[model samples]
Target: MQNSATIASDFAELPATASRGPLRIEYRWINDAAADTRADTRIAVFLHEGLGSIAMWRDWPQALCERLGMRGLVYSRPGYGLSTPRAHGVKWPVDFMAHQACDVLPALLDALDIDMPARQRTWLIGHSDGGSIALLYAARHAGALAGAVTIAPHVFVEDISVQSIAQTKQLYETTDLRNKLGRYHADVDSAFYGWNDIWLNPAFRQWSIVGELAAIREPLLAIQGHDDNYGTMAQIDTIAQHVPHARLVKLDACGHSPHRDVPDKLNDAIAAFIASQT
Candidate 1:
């Protein structure tokens, strides 16, 4: 793992925010120095977890972009990172994640001028909540994406997930978890409640993307850890059952965050999957 000081230095020269209205998005680009200077390599847009921000991703995105010989876009959603804070006393609607998938992502893509004609090939690499957003985006914008790699994404709220979230709530209240998360989220409460309230909501408990999974025809790779406490292997299993052609990878002795827990193994698998698609 890259130390916080090193991560800070890498991001030190990044461009400052140009706007802070309805959405607070920051952007960065990575160019392949090793390639023939003229070619426009395809890009990978990384979406972080609910509590994650660009700063939290550290050097992983940079490392991946370098390894794949591609550019990368890493940003913070509204209410996280340096973006706009969530409205006070506002509770996210049950379909908040859907809104993010259908609205915010497209808006950000357009804002960054990433919607080029032949540049239609986009690779989405998302983690946890971001992973779910990636799936939803692929479901809606079918042919626009080359493929997606999702790690520990949830299609529905499992009992295990709820239980773990409940424990997280307790930890937040009684321990230093909030302070730890504060390092990532600009407004930790906003980020926490935005995600926590939705998952614990009665209506959201039954929320499932099984229908959407079937609609996704793009190449898909869903990865989960066998020892993940927040969700079971059944999440990816269900996706595979719905989208029979989707490939599934179950990592042994791993937890929810595969990229963080098993970086080399996860990167190798993702690289092979992307190559196979081409």
Candidate 2:
């Protein structure tokens, strides 16, 4: 396999056939390596957190892809980055994450012409809300993925999560959180309000994907921080209980984001796990 020198960036507009009306996605191709190696390579698709966008991931995805000598596809979900924003006054439903996994993500891959079942099955690396989306996708389309890695994923909404979200709403209104977040998003309001409004919705409190976990037949690596304020060890533990071959890792001194808090350890663990699987 030829190893390239740098990452490449591109965008794809979903076609009418994808059923996702006029959506444009911003994506990055990291560690392109070489054209000759494309056929045999397994691509890692990185999905960002709730408020995260392509730029928000910064250099982490590229760093990991380089470490593994793997190519990676990192994209911003609609409404999060330079991608299409949610229409004004529109609200996401309780099963928004499912919609993302089953519809948006598939449409994106299709738009990019990356066939998942045609010897191009991907390795999904997702964080927080993205992690939950990864789990849903793996369960619904088991054969499309080689494996899944979730960091700080939430299978069920917790009271602490709600409380933290409430505080974030306050920060958005009172502090400079909006301005700070604006650097990473094209439409700051669309990203923050869309995520904040949904989680804080009363009906969302009952949202749970516990039943869906059992259907995830692919190997899983569930990582979470012992000190995470948004979720607890139960999140990863429950996943392990259902996914027979699942592995769990709890990082000490790391809060919600192990990638950011302890990237070296996180990358080592992920690279080793992916290598073992292959």
Candidate 3:
């Protein structure tokens, strides 16, 4: 028996649903032509941040897919978006992000039927926690990957990361944060605490995948903001140290989320990297 999420391409600018393992996943393909036989058609899978879903990504994936002329896939992981919410008593494990990378992502890809040239041309574009997941997936499945790009990814836990998340936890409780996030999730608490709790857990302070990055043979680009609120440049710097061939892009006047803060620059860098890699 295998664990996987199942969905086909050819969606009409709308999201679709599928089931992965015991969880139902909400996913959608962008600008995909089911019958297009162009040799250069590519696939870029977008992995959102810890508290992000397909809706939270807004039109960024569509914009990037158009910019790079590649098919794109976006999804909400378990306990996110319109997918099944986390059970009331269930708590995510310390290795939640790693499980997302090693287990959930692979299963989703298999179910999406990415066993074509897209498999070889596939690129993972991840942000924040998603960036870390992208790195782990590339390390574990380099042979099936073409390239990867990470934005503000955490290779290791940092004091500042914990501080900011803890602060946001307060916001989620005291402010309209939950109301704002509610627009993107079916169960805001499930989406919020599922990510928040594990990240702030004492056991997670030691969570780091820096050692496994050595196995990533695929072309990789790591991006970070000069003024990121979460992790520091050490995150991407460590990535460069581990994967010597990985390209590093440091953006000035940017914060944690580059796609939102500096979309033009991020898009250009992504387009250039993919062009150069291809």
Candidate 4:
């Protein structure tokens, strides 16, 4: 486990356009150190949390890419990071995560010229809400990916998640949380409120992805922290039950964000998993 986190690297955004929507999206590219010397390695796509952005991933993605000799693409969703913000007063629906996986991500990938079945298929590494999106995408587009790694993914909404989010909402309003998060997002309010409202909405309590996970045929690695405030072991347990080929890792003293809390262990586990699959 790492004692401290690395500083986030500065990232530049390239506008990615697609027909499904998100006229413009934000993305960054990290070339492998040996790109000039070796053939391209597999592509690793890093999807941030509901409230996360490309910058929030800090140096973690680059570190992982360096270890595996893989090329990396880290991007911010429409309402986070330097990406486009959500329209005013628009609350994400219960199926919002689904939309992100099934529509938004594919379009963004296309815009980036990452065509599947032609060029190298990408591997997905997602955190928190991003993890859930990864699952959905793998389920829907199993043939398009090499594998997936989900850190602190949610298969279903839990009371603990709702409660913790409520606390974050309070903190955002009362503390410096907003000011701090603002540094990572273009529109901090849009990023925070967009994620917070949907999770807290009464209708969202029944949202679940357990049924959809069975369709995913790609090898998957589900990781979670034992002390994660937002979810429990049941999340990954359910994933294992649904995706028979899935692997699970539970870390002690780690929180919701394993990439941040136990980076060394998380990176090692991820590298091993990817190696086993490749």
Better of 1 and 3 by TM-score: 3
Q: Write the per-residue lDDT of candidate 2 for residues 8-53, one digit (tens) a residue.
A: 4478887654534677888887777732477667778999999998
RMSD of each: 3.9, 2.8, 5.9, 3.4
User: What is the TM-score of each predicted model, taking all chains together?
Assistant: 0.90, 0.94, 0.91, 0.91
Q: Candidate 1: lDDT over CA atoms?
A: 0.79
| lDDT (Cα atoms) of all candidates against the true structure | 0.79, 0.87, 0.85, 0.85
Model 1 stretches astray by more than 4 angstroms: 1-21, 31-38
lDDT (C-alpha) at residue 56 in model 4? 86
| Candidate 2, residue 267: how far the Cα is off, in Å | 0.6
Q: Which candidate, 2 or 3, would have the higher TM-score against the true structure? A: 2
lDDT of 1 by residue, 1-278 (tens): 23333433222112323432356565555444523553556778899987788888877887787777777778787767766668767777777778778878887777666665423677999998899999999899888878899999999889999899888888988999999989877788988888787788888888888788898889999999999998998899998998888899899879988878888888888888888988
Q: What's the TM for model 2?
A: 0.94
Clashes by residue pair, model 2: 4-33
